[model samples]
Target: MPLQKSPTGTWLPARVPQSTITLAILLVLCSMVQSTTGGYDGSMLNGLNILPPYTDYFNLNAATTGLNTASVFIGGFFGPMAAGVMADKFGRRIAIFWGCIITIVGVILQTAAQNIAMFVVARVFIGFGTAVDGIAAGVYLSETFPSRWRAWGVGLFNDFYYVGALIAAGITLGTGKWQSTWAWRAPSLFQGIFSIMCIMILPFVPESPRWLIHEGYYEEARTVVAQTNADGNPSDPVVLTVYKEILDTLEWEKKEGRTMSPKEIIKTPVARKRLLIGMSAGPFSCVVGNIIASYYLTYELDTAGVTDSTDQLKANVVLNVWCLGCALAGTHLVANWGRKGTALLSQTLLVICLFIIGGLSKKYADNPNAASNSLIYGNVAVMFLFQGFYSIAWTPLLYLYPPEVMNYSIRANGLAFSQFMLNALAVLLVFVEPIGIVNIGWKMYMVNASWDIIIIVLIAVYWVETKGRTLEEIDAIFEGQKHSTVPDVEAVRKGEATVNLAELEKEVAATALIVEK
Candidate 1:
């Protein structure tokens, strides 16, 4: 049967039930906590670094400060090693809950730290927990949302990171005048709130239907598919189609003896390509010069002649707000422009902005007194533009693109490995950025801009568009054969279409035999 279009010409039914919308909102809110907590941790550290009390209390120099900032990634580096196993073995929701619990413990330790050693240890835990939570949440969001809503659902997940960052920046800015350790400790203590929110919301949300099918809970998976996609109408054509597709795909995967092992990722040419593209989001996001602004904004601002602490804090607040707006806009862009197009546009603009900023900074930043006010201001303006463009594609795509491209068998593990690479590289760069800023000054931006030019080419060559396709349907792109056995929903609804599961299974077996022969 041919695929039929909705009368309303939208991806979903025009009049979706209110209950479905409510469920989607809840799932988005719950999944958003991982990024929100991360944003808060990063912005809090950035804000605290600017405060005299935080620097004085820790006795931080460039090296120690880099160690302190990089410690979270160090912890994150180890977390994904176990994140994949926990998410796959236990369940996505369980992994998220436990990860949040671990983060809360880290938050408590960080709040009461009397020495730098205690603080660093605490950050490591926070990093580990957040990493685990992040991978699970990314997979959960990608798996649970309907195909029509998946891009926005997963895109907004990381956009909320700015929400957490904005809050942390505001709190730290407000508390900057305090002459005590609480100025820094207060922000540290607040990092757990988002995790706690995630824990609270998880009970009200459903698990991924795909995960349910993978674990042999067919009825439960079907029920979830109906609840989320068809508003509890089990007989609805959309629900039936999705449910059947998931079943057939999983059945085929099993007959082919696929496993979730890492080795399976590199077992074939297509699999290797999928792994490379899925992992690309990690390092591409980290290497784009955002690290300098994310963790070392104060240092960057000082070099640009914004020497006052108050001014710097205010700039941090504005930058987070700006990034949030741009990231939200990017969610819409991905739907209209497609993934590859939006990324290409964003990367091109980033290169241009970074190049100009480098030139302006090199000319004026070294001699702020001798520089004209407009020249100094131009450098700052370009910096904001660079971040804004960065937010447009990289921020939303950071979490959205990776899981969409990977099949269920390796999605959880692939996400973990991608995150591990991100953390590993972040550990080095976050540590090295401050030193680079102190030693090489503005040339760092130039170097980073040059690197981004190459990234644009890689993205053009490697990334595939995943717009407007169901998770099971995406496998067709990778394997050059449609995995879904479901027919048209409209035909199914009219009782004009039927699927023969036994025949489908026989066909799959025959295909496998041909491959072996």
Candidate 2:
């Protein structure tokens, strides 16, 4: 459905320094840390998969592996909510900076871990720190950028996430030493360093303008928002318009009811549902896509004749390279088509692809190879297709949507709940995946594919259009059709709910102290 603008007229631009490149650089640098942290986890997933094979190295069994894997996710589950709350209680910069400290400590503990028990404990800290960074990245990027580039900025900030996975794959391949501890530990340590560096460097960048505004630091907020290079000062016209809107939104919000607060997130039905949908959508992507990929790494490698550490590394390199292609395709399609349409269609196509890949995998397993390696090659091709298509459509954007779905009140809480569900789903799937490969064989792929089909149905039925929708529009949708489809008493009476967060940001930032006469 096409959107109708409320009195706010959808998202309005907040002018920033002309040096958008500097802002872009800070955003990208932040993403590198995002990618690196994820890369560490991806490496662990791959390395741990192979660990079960070499009992002598880790002395790990299925039960231990389950505990270890689940441990990290369990940690990740709570960390986002905690970060979100702390972020609000304090500020974005402190929340993120402290997350780096936690991350480094977690990495050190994990690196020195002498047993699976120690490893599991350390993993929790890692999960906690990582979640803080990830959620903080989402909140930070959204609040930091102007509206015109919001989607692309989010996407671009997140793209390095996939790129991080590729880098981790390459690191694994380069080592050709998955049998050793460094195969996993080294990546974690390296990423920890990167995370810490990001925190240290963040001091040089400005704080979130909206956040500054929210605290009623109007002068500082204005100076930052209207900052420039030629004279490095705020221009008069820019200052006036920005100041006006800030007052406008605050007045409109008061005219409506109460000032927005996080506690009110679940107070109403629409707010409650928005929180649920927002949180679930992100981690849901992982439950179906990422966890499944991590689960089946070994089985796929074996099918491709990548049995040993060396060969397995080679297979990953191939998958990594192919995955980049798929990421590109997925991104291109989604950009033009819109998220819901693309997500539904991709999920539809994924079901079909999974059937083909699974069926081909079964045949390849039985025959191993035939007609000059045609069957295995075909299987590999399908696997690539599965990863590529899903990577593009399902990968980055799934992470994007949930956070976008909710407004400020319940954003963190919603994300926290969803990550918990997602982590739990991942744990079950991860455990089931290996067992399925050994016991159920190619039938498991059919199961995953079928499950996705069911999820797509859910998507079609309940999924709302989020692309191009402002945060308020999303909140309206989340508030549900009952609250939103017909205008509210206020919206009807006033002809719209007029809130310009852009202007609210100005007074909130309190730029008077920062701006020069």
Candidate 3:
């Protein structure tokens, strides 16, 4: 169904039932823990790097520091290899529970590290577990929420990453003055808290209805749909409409003999296109010049003349706060500007910010005197501005768009592939960022801005709008069908909508035939 304007003249419905809102809140709170863990790790490391005790104890130069930081992504790189299969075979909840367990083990090892080797090894496990937990939680959020709430629910999941960052920043800042090794160890140990929170919350949350249906739990799936969408009124029109769409779409896919293999992701032209766009979320997020700010804030701040440790830590805290606000605003903007429009606007602004940052850094970074302080401050302001824009679109879209474009059959594996791409690029680029900043200075931003322009062109040419559509309805756009299996809920309730199932089946058959040819 097309979107309806609310009484407030916005695209949002006039009012959602309190029950649905409560459920959305609960699910978002639960799923957000995974991202919070990741955010904490990044921020905690950034904070640690700034501490004399941390650097002195580890004797970390640029190369070793890069390795220590990249260790998590290295573990993340291998995580998706098994995470996809586990999520599909075991269940999203089980995968999350086990992933958290692994993360806790890693945290224990990391907190008590005897040497750099042990620290690196512990981080690998943490990265691995985070990857597993993140993929399952991401899929769960996308598949479990009611259609109207899906974007906000999933978008908010990653937005809370900044919440973790903020918490870590505050904690590390509090611990920065400690003379003992506990200064760093205390933060490392705290990293396990988010995963533990996730484990506790999982028991109360419902499984993904799509996963339930795929596993032959039809009644359970229908009941979940009703509970989430219609407050447990099984016969509610919206519930019936959404339930029918899922059933019919899954049936059509089953009849077409869909498999869960990663190879299935590229079996046809449409599928290939979906893979490209879905996986693009990974590189788009990593290469957008945000990595420098995210992982190397201390280095960036020092270069920009904010060399005081307390001042740099304060900037980290403030930056996360700014990003959290912008990311939340971006989620709301998805309704008005849509996925494509929000992304374009964000990248456009990011490019402009990067150029300004590069110019200012060139002018003042090498010589941090009184007269150039304002320009240095401007450079710092642009860095914060760049992060804000990155958070606005990329943070939410990183998890939201990939799962939206993927169908049930390949959603798990496809997301795993996307994670694989993200971690793979991150391991390389995150490791290289400090070196780039050291060697090329301001030119690093210029290089990133140049590449970002290419991504903007690619998005405009290739990306499809997924706003205001249900998961099943989106399939129609790629399948060359004139109508979606989903009926308009309000119209159906008012006896104004008609569904032609036989015609839909024929269209599905024709599309399948085309793929076969």
Report the Cα RMSD per candidate.
Answer: 6.4, 7.9, 6.9
lDDT (CA) for every model shown?
Answer: 0.84, 0.60, 0.83
Ranking by TM-score: 1, 3, 2
Question: How do the residues 1-517 of candidate 3 rate in per-residue lDDT, one tens digit apiece?
Answer: 1221112111111222236556667688888987899999999999999999899999999999999999999999999888889888888878888899999999999999989999999999999999998998888899888767788999999999999999999999999999999999999999999998987776556677777777766666666776678666756667767766777777777777788877888877777888888878877888889888888999898777788999999999999999999999999887557998999999999999999888888877556575366776888998999999999999899889988888878888888899999999999998999999999988998999999999999989888998877788788778865134557544564577865556554543454343333
lDDT of 1 by residue, 1-517 (tens): 1221112211112122226677788889988976799999889998999999999998999999998899999889999998988888878888998899999999999999998899889999999999999999999999989877888999999999999999999999999999999999899888899999998877667777877777765666666777677766656667767777777777778777888776777777877888899889988999988999999998888778788899999999999999999999998999777999999999999999888988888887667679988887888898998888999998889888889898888888888889999999999999999999888888998999999999999999978998877777778888887666567444564577875656654543444343233
Model 2 earns a TM-score of: 0.81
- Prediction 1 TM-score vs. true: 0.92
Please give the lDDT score at residue 515 for candidate 1: 28
Off by over 4 Å in 1: 1-18, 488-517
Candidate 3 Cα errors over 4 Å, as ranges: 1-18, 482-486, 489-517
Error of 1 at 167 (Å): 0.1
lDDT over C-alpha atoms for residue 427 of model 3: 97
Query: Considering only N, C-alpha and C atoms within 3 Å, which residue pairs clash in candidate 3?
Result: none
lDDT of 2 by residue, 1-517 (tens): 1211111111222322245456556665764565457655665456545643323446766666666766777677778668777666566666677777787888899877778778788888888887777677667666555443455666555555556666666765654455576756665566576677677556445555555655665555555545421112354443334343333333333444533455656777766777765665765476454455554476665655446766565666567667666666665665566767877877777788889877777776676645236666677677767776777766656556666776655565565566667766665666666666767777877887777877787778876666655343454464443222222222322335444445544543453333211
The alpha-carbon lDDT assigned to residue 84 of candidate 1 equals 86
